[model samples]
Target: MRNIRIGDYLVEKQLITQEQLENALAVQRESKGTKKFGEVIVELGYLSEVKFAQALAGKLHVPYVDLSNFDIDGEAVRKVPETLAKKYTIIAINIKGKRLTVATDDPYNFNILEDVKVMTGMDTDPVFATRTAINKAIGKFYSMQNVDSVLEGVQAFSDMNNAEDDEESKDRVESAPIVKLATTIVENSYRADATDIHIEPFKTYTRIRIRVNGDLVELMNVANVVHNALTTRLKLISGMNIAEKRVPQDGRFTQVVDGTTLDVRVSS
Candidate 1:
């Protein structure tokens, strides 16, 4: 027996009308195999993203995961580095013996599954998730690892401040750990396609939030001690006046990540 196509399955399940599926198929063909049928369906407003993902899970006979409320294991996340996870749009959800289970937006991508298996040295099991959920989870979990490093850098910076004069301390503010933390924030924001990044300072800690899909999500928080250094580093790069605290400032800078230049607008 021949396997039923996704569009036919969707029509059979009453998720999308036959006319909508025909239109989606036409658009998909026009893309020269560049776009997936489900993507075309969602883009054309034939179905919601979540519903398409659920239907895809059923069609593929794979479990569908709602990452928004799911509790993720940190160890599984660690097994797959942030860079690799982002590259493939896959997140490690569980690991048992030599098998690694991951949540992915595209379960049919056998190449990615094979690459992950080779990289992790385990058999790969993929579950279905919406692309939006996978991206949010990556931003939420991977960025947490960087938060710990940023805190440690804050303590080391404090120690250096005690031993150095004002002039020398100004130079040390560009220390390695803090610099990486600052750059990582920008990179993550760019990767998430965020429209804005908010760094809010409070009495005891500083909050970092990014605007994704028109929603402001808190990325992470760090100690108040690192706030000054972090702001200074960002200001220097953006050409803002680091010495002037009372006045509002606006500036723009270009960052190169993965050979792609991104224009960053800063307002303080």
Candidate 2:
């Protein structure tokens, strides 16, 4: 699957006529083969990776995914061997029920789908992604096991705070838990390259989601009590009036993470 270039895929799928491929190939051959077929074709304004990814989605009848900022699940990642994942340019992203969701650059390869199913003993749902994306995902997921564990622990801080509803003590009533939760949520989202961190209040609880890879994925859920405090903290940090909950307000604040400054907007 690693060698299955987009040019062959386009030709095989009839998205690119053979004459077009042959012409592109001729250009490459004439250049002393210094250029790739897809490269020459793209340079000639015939195709692009983004357009090709869209076309591939149509050809395979599968959803095309942008893997940028996609947080790989650690448990799901451990289900498949890293060697197999790298060789096929595939990433095991999620597991739910009896289904294992795998993202890869080659969605047309039915063999890869079947192999993962047999190997993991879970039904494999193949998601199409760019080759560069698949490679990056695989590397990121396998490279830092310790960092992943720390993130999970940080997430637990919020959850542990929520479970103390019956305490009603100074600790539970204090802003420390909510502040810690808010800080953790922001830092985690920043690390994951999230476009926005959504803090939504739901009836008796709260749902925290982050925009990553153009998709909204749930990060955590905590008690509404915790969310209230967290919301106030966010408003204050963003320079919004924290007491005015009924009226919608928007403000932004800047933070420096790893030497890069980022602006975070808050609204309600």
TM-score of each: 0.67, 0.44
In model 1, state the lDDT of residue 152.
Answer: 78
- Model 1: residue 16 alpha-carbon error in angstroms: 1.4
RMSD of 1: 5.5
Q: Write the per-residue lDDT of candidate 1 for residues 208-229, one digit (tens) a residue.
A: 9999999999877776667777
Clashing pairs in 1: none
lDDT for residue 233 in candidate 1, whole number 0-100: 82
TM-score of 1: 0.67
- Write the residue-wise lDDT of candidate 2 on 249-268 in tens digits: 98998876433577887778
Predictions in order: lDDT: 0.82, 0.72
C-alpha lDDT of candidate 1 relative to the true structure: 0.82
Best by TM-score: 1
What is the TM-score (0 to 1) of candidate 2? Answer: 0.44
Clashing pairs in 2: none
